[model samples]
Target: MTDVAFDAHDGIGAGGTADVRRRMRDELRQWAILAVGSLAIAGVFAFMLAVSRLPGIERVLPWPTGFFAKGLVIHVVFSLVVWFLTTFALLASIATLNATEEGPRLASLGATGAHLVALAFPFLLAPAFFNDSVASLNNYVPVIVHRSYYLGLLLFGLGIALPAVRLLANVGARRLQDFGHLALAMSAGAVIYIIALTCIALALSLSWGSEPGRTFHEHLFWGGGHVLQFLYALLMLTGWFVLLRSSLGETSFDADVFRLAIVLLAAFTLPAVFFYKVFEPFSPLQTEAFRRLQFVVALPSLIIAVGGLSGVLAARRRGPLPWHDPGFLALVLSPIVFGAGGIMGLMITGSDTRTPAHYHGTIAGVNLALMGLFLVHCLPALGRSVPPSRTVRAQILLFGFGQLVACLGLFWAGGYGAPRKMPAGAAHLVDGAVIGMYLHGVGALFAVIGGVLFVSTVARALLRQQPAAPGINSAAGSLTQIKGRRGGR
Candidate 1:
């Protein structure tokens, strides 16, 4: 059990004292509970998705089709939206500790409670309410229109927003230039996302009487959903930069470039808010305007991505890298899938299978980066060491390849005009296009398996307590070296 010295420049460095380390460990471990819990549930829903799509598999199960649909919506909202937000909050809480040496204990606990409630809500009520209550399968924020669901969302949003606002305001109060650009960017993005959701909730309340059911939910979440994409992109890029820097063993990219990227991402997101708030809150015009703006939101990520790759290459020229590093391998594979997603996106015309192809690849890319960061950084921070396992090394590849195959199948079927979200075993063209559907199904199954494995590995790592490495964890390493040099002199 050794201590890893915290570097001030790393943006998340807390004090190297044992007590501070213990506190940080406790905070991260609590966060891990929520993260692992959400992910595990996410994995279950993912597996169920396969069953729901695999024709006979779903019917033999105890649940009905509507139940699966309802659960799927709940799963998506919690897994994709809530899980990411909570993780961002965890990051923010850490940065807050590093920057100010104070923990957002109340905020973190409140958010954890909210997440648990949200995660448990559908399971508790879905079976009984599936037929009576409508599952508004909106693009985002899909939840059954139950009072309990709404309450859970309210609690969740407030839980995240309050702390995020505190963090952003705290950072702004201090000299912003002193903090790492990625941390600042992530905090700002979190705040903006919460604010955007708040405004959307308000707008939805106002327009609730006019539109009904899923239509209202659609209008409610459309503008906010578009804005959320920016938040996701920011976090994804933040993960990319952090993991890339860690893999290279240096924070090689310029802080200013990272700052500018964050600034540009924030700047691009503002237009959507203006369009929604100042012009019209819930309208097709607002949706269209925001939709168009979503195109360039990834500009910041692209800039940083290219810059990061260049920096890594430059660093490689200086010395040989640990090519077998699992984290580095995950980082290397991320952008490839992301690029595949982007390319697949260009082929999307109207409602077709390619839509899922584009998103699955893109989302999988982000998930991969986050997973790498968790394994290489978060676990270490939590006083847990990643076990050296070949299966651990292969998780990312399996997931990435699964996504690639799935997307390719989607693109193939889409080329033949197969519609998106079509039920399994439904009527389809009796041609080569059918093979594409088969590939889609098969790929989806593998993706689920990979996803389960990834989740299981993370859970295992988190649960298995390990002593931190001495040279890796202790501030004494550098101090002793300095003392040794002085004694030599």
Candidate 2:
């Protein structure tokens, strides 16, 4: 692995004949990401926000599915595509910082291209055109989409190819001896997630309509929900990098531990190997066996969370570290919250109480971690230092905590047979159910406030800034200097 540095301007290369291809690849990657994001946002505006699950089909889809499709397309797109793109770019930045690793560089480029295709075609078009392409049982867009949708998915898959290369190509942060471990584990886990989902997608296509494919139909999308929970967890693992970096500076993460966790994440795929047909009203043997496998898939993941969190906390230098700021505090709280959710899942029996508790915990924590870290990157450009922002971020922290509590309440309510994603809010609650939902709603409001403030800060930063230097260069510098001096108060 040769050292690399981030040169967003010059083009990506070490100044050889390869430089032309490298620059083209690198610049193309950058341009592709921007282009896809632009189009995706437009498509989302045109298609999403209101028309999510297409009403009357409410009973046909899952509780979460309707809301996720309609209201949360933004979150889904950002979570699956934007988050990775940002992370990929960040990795490229790190690779650039390191001054080497053609694979990561290429991965970055490919992801950019993939994102563009995903945005324009499947994501944009499928929702726009396909009535048959339903938001299906597995909480993802199913085989209801048309051929164009498949192409979009294929393009996204192609984009994923780069990350796969990085996992094997071995190039990232030079400071860490095991730079590639986390990347490899995440790649494998993501692959499993995609494959499982793809199988479900394919099964959906073949099983529905005039003829159904029963064997494959029963196998896919049944336990796939739990597997997706693992995917969320897998992503949250990246937060460990921030955890590792901030706490002891750098501990050189345990590669074996990370890999084991990836395996734990993928453990659910093993059940697919047995390939049994299942449906409601199964015989006692099948029900019991299926239940056992479900629990089995969860246990190791539970262990992985425990191990990962414990490793991070114990790995800490043992001094009182910054936890008051929303960003850093969110980092501290993510795994803890996610672990709590996982624990809830471990202690239940299809009662619906524990699983989404774990789901919300893990997913919310992952969101907070990702958003919080990105804020860390983008916030500093505005003028506030990480330490200082922590001091002023009280409202932000309170908002997040409020949201967590509310979500937790919703989880408990769901366990006791309360529904999620209701437009009715507390009105839908019956008897004591209202208590949990009301709490959840109130918490949501605060979470919204915190989120708003975070965005506000970013917006403020991106606005034109007074230059740090003055007229040593030109009249532009003089104007900047004058503006800075005038605003110095």
Candidate number of the best lDDT: 1
* TM-scores for all predictions: 0.85, 0.62
lDDT of 2: 0.46
Predicted candidate 1 versus true structure: per-residue lDDT over 1-489, tens digit per residue: 111212243223234455555554565566666666677877677667666666566457666537666777767875687677777766666555544443333434534544554565455345423556557778767867666667667666666665566566556655655654434766668666875786587667768677458878887777788788778777777777666655664445655676678778877776665675566666666667877887896689789888888988897888976556667767777888877888888778888888888887888787777777677666665546576477777777777777778888888888888887656656566465688888877887777777778778878877774555332233223111111111111
Top-TM-score candidate index: 1
- Regions more than 4 Å wrong, model 1: 1-24, 52-65, 102-129, 277-281, 315-321, 465-489
Error of 1 at 233 (Å): 0.7
TM-score of 1: 0.85
Each model's backbone clash number: 7, 14
Task: Give one digit per residue, the lDDT tens place, for model 2 in 1-489.
Answer: 001111221223323344344443333334333423432453344334444446755565443433443334334544444444444433333233223323234434444544554454445344434444433322432332345544655565455445444443433333332334334445445455555555455445544553322233244444444345455555566555443343333333343454566566576665642433443322455435544554554455555456556655664556655554455566666666656666666665664434556556655666666555444532231122234364336544755576577667777666567754344432345665667666766876676566556544544443435455221111111111111111111
